[model samples]
Target: MAEVEAADFETAIAECGFGLFNVFILISSVPCLTAMVFSAATLSYVMPSAECDLKLSLLDRGMLNAATYAGMIFSAIPWGFIADTMGRRVVLICGGWLDGFFVLCAAFSQDFLQLMVFKFIDGLIICGPFAVVVSYLAEFHGKKHRAYVMLFVGLSVSVGAMILPLMAYCLLPVHIFFNVGQLQFHTWQIFIAITSLPSLLSGFLHMFLPESPKFLMSQGNYNKALISLQRIYALNNRKSRDSYPVKKLTDATPDRSDVINNPNPRRSRQERYKLAKKKFCDGLMQLRPMCSSPFLGLSIQVYCLHFCQIMCVNSVRLWLPQIFATMHTFRIRGMNDTSMCAVMDHNTHGRPIDTKSMEEECDIHQDPDMYIDNIVVAAVGLAGFILIFPFLRIAIVANHILKVFLFLSTFLVGGLYFSKTTLTTLILSSIYLTMMGVCATTIISMSVVIFPTLMRTMVLLLIMTFGRLGSVVGNVLLPIFMQISCIAPFLWLCTLMTIAFTISLFLKVDVQQSLN
Candidate 1:
């Protein structure tokens, strides 16, 4: 095995310049991650309508919310290995198209079983695109620009969360009813379709993308790595390919051939099976080193911190809209989104709410105002991420800063449900939401800065995977617990977040060294 140094690769990438190339990738990958957000959070758009027609129980709706993540909880780590084996491009292309197809199928599902199946497949397929984007973007830039790239992508995700309901606001109210045999076309269907387009479109667009240079280098394709870097340099600097800088990387760079992608052209089925078994065994052996001795402790620490962080942050992201909507019913002046959807729902049955009332007791009204509020709060959160990025040049400061914000946000939210007036609750909620973006950016930045290059991709994927697991558990229990008491869900959030905060107290990472 030959060496491929990070500094050498980093220098070649840095010569590519952080202009048009990084901007293009940063823009394209946004929709991929945001589509994952839609997949996990689509229940927000669907529940209000499902409450009208599907006649779903509160628990049933919660299951639907968790369905995609149910798939995610099990799929991500395996997908990480696949990404390492088959290459990022294949995963993104296949996963992107499959996710859209599954989501589209889910939109047409006539029963709970069908919807869950399709949504699970959607989650299964999406893990690739979402997880690969982290590594893909990192491979495109030098370390100096990597944090900015992640922050920008995070900002895009925040914007996506903000715009989802606004888009739902515009499209979900349309009374566009038509039929294709057993299928009915309506707002939720339309919203699902619109959200699915980005993934489908991006997937096809990705067909034209090159494999990650770092992945190529890992595969011992130094020529291909050089070509990829040269291409990026030309695009970013608006120069001819021949004129790009950084002709070659150092020959003495580290050899990471253990995880490199290699495919044989002609092999028997039995031979392939044996090869896979051997590779799997070998990969397990490789992982054992990281899980034992000195690296073992840090590995466990990072995963636990990640698990706890995801448990708290994802819970908040997944349920933000519903929590806001539930809070809306307490409003004396605003009409809930239920009333807004009345016009669309009544088109099917002359009286939709009347029919739904016979099935289950409905209490809180869905307010579209909360959509606007989410968008505004999300914008504020985006600002928080941007505000924190510069300070993140100091890695220790980043983690500590996040801890302080987490403490404050928890306090605001824990007191929110106990507020004396609706106004006080609203104020607390706004500040709580504002703090979310800051917390999110910090988590990602710390992970990127602190983890080693060899382990970075796997760690990020685990963070995302466990984050989905958190969402699955949180959404499932949120409505059930909220039914018990107004403060019950927040208390749950506070406990998980406090646990995350406490975990951070003991877990240690070489944040300053990784950055330097």
Candidate 2:
């Protein structure tokens, strides 16, 4: 027999080059942008001036705020298992449109119960795509660039924040009204419809995009994986199949821990059944290590890190818009009452009011910069993404920079709490968003390094599940804390994050392996 050398599948991908194929993969992951839409919807959906305000109390309001995330925490594990089984594309397509349908249903909801129910179901399935998109995009890249690719995909959070408020500003102020069969349509309802469009389009877009080549290889569909690689090569090189370089992909180093091996080409039906059973058993066996001993402690540490990151970030984020709204209201209140609009006189008299008779209690004119402020904060996060995401390429600094950023975040919370003016608050919040960009990206990058392919997505989901749980707690408690004092929520956040920072110092991540 002749001796031969095999190239790593990752090496083969690098040979194909990073061009249109990489850009295509980037576009494919854009659906992840919709991940924050449900949370942002609450910013616009339940506004005070909104015609159909639920008129909810503090606790009720908190629950409504957390409802989508509550559904996500519940569904995370099950959805991950499904993505690992039924295939990522199917789950994304179905989940994406289903989320759109339910969110659309929420727009017409008559009561808090209806809105909450629809929003919950929307999050239940939508989280499948949100949790898997990073892993999916990472898998498509060569190991040298995988972590950075995932980081770019994670920018969807900032993109969502920028988008939601811009759309709301345009639609919310318009007092459109119409009726059909006891259902009423208004500017708010129209806003929900527009926002849900992404959820509707994401699935359809995936219809054209190929599955992760790494996923195909994992499933023992080597030929299919090769075809995927060839397609990417063709797209990147602007050449046909004949010009594609690679004849076949070879796993130079096969993963011993992976339960599902390349399938036997010549197996009987009974043998296939036996293989399936063995694979299932192997998966359960593989999980034992992560769920126990040294790995178990690490898993707990990672979960807490992610939880704190989300809690600190979202606790401030979900409330920031409302805070801005309130600040503008106070500014208006302090201004001259001469600027007020005339109240309709329908209740007191069946005639129009004189110009001098305008009520002093008329609604304040909303600040023009409010939506722009949301975009600015989100853009600040993007700037952080640009600055920190690339640094992962430097193995030595990746771990150290993240730790330094984490420590700074604790102090940043104090800055946010004591910010007296809206300008100061915005500047502090923008800085916080930048930290969130670095901090949250670090968590995902760490996940990629810590776990192998077999359990990578599953473990990522577990981290996200814990993170969403923290978000739920923050949403539930922030309102209550605000009742006591303006600074209480940030103070409590600072205390919680101090514990997170201490734990992170002890975290022993393999940053070199993560960057590959």
RMSD of 1: 5.6
lDDT tens readout by residue for model 2, 347-369: 11222144332222123323444
TM-score of model number 2: 0.85
How high is the CA lDDT of each candidate model? 0.67, 0.68
Summarize candidate 1's per-residue lDDT along 276-310 as a digit string, tens digits. 89877754553454556665676565566556666
lDDT of 1 at 380: 66
Model 1, position 96: C-alpha lDDT score: 88
Model 2 bad stretches (over 4 Å): 1-5, 35-46, 50-52, 242-248, 252-286, 335-362, 365-369, 512-516
The window of 10 residues in a row where model 2 has the poorest summed lDDT is 338-347
Model 1 stretches astray by more than 4 angstroms: 1-7, 242-245, 251-282, 326-370, 394-396, 420-422, 507-516
lDDT of 2 at 53: 45
Q: Assess the local accuracy of residue 277 in candidate 1 as a C-alpha lDDT between 0 and 100.
A: 95
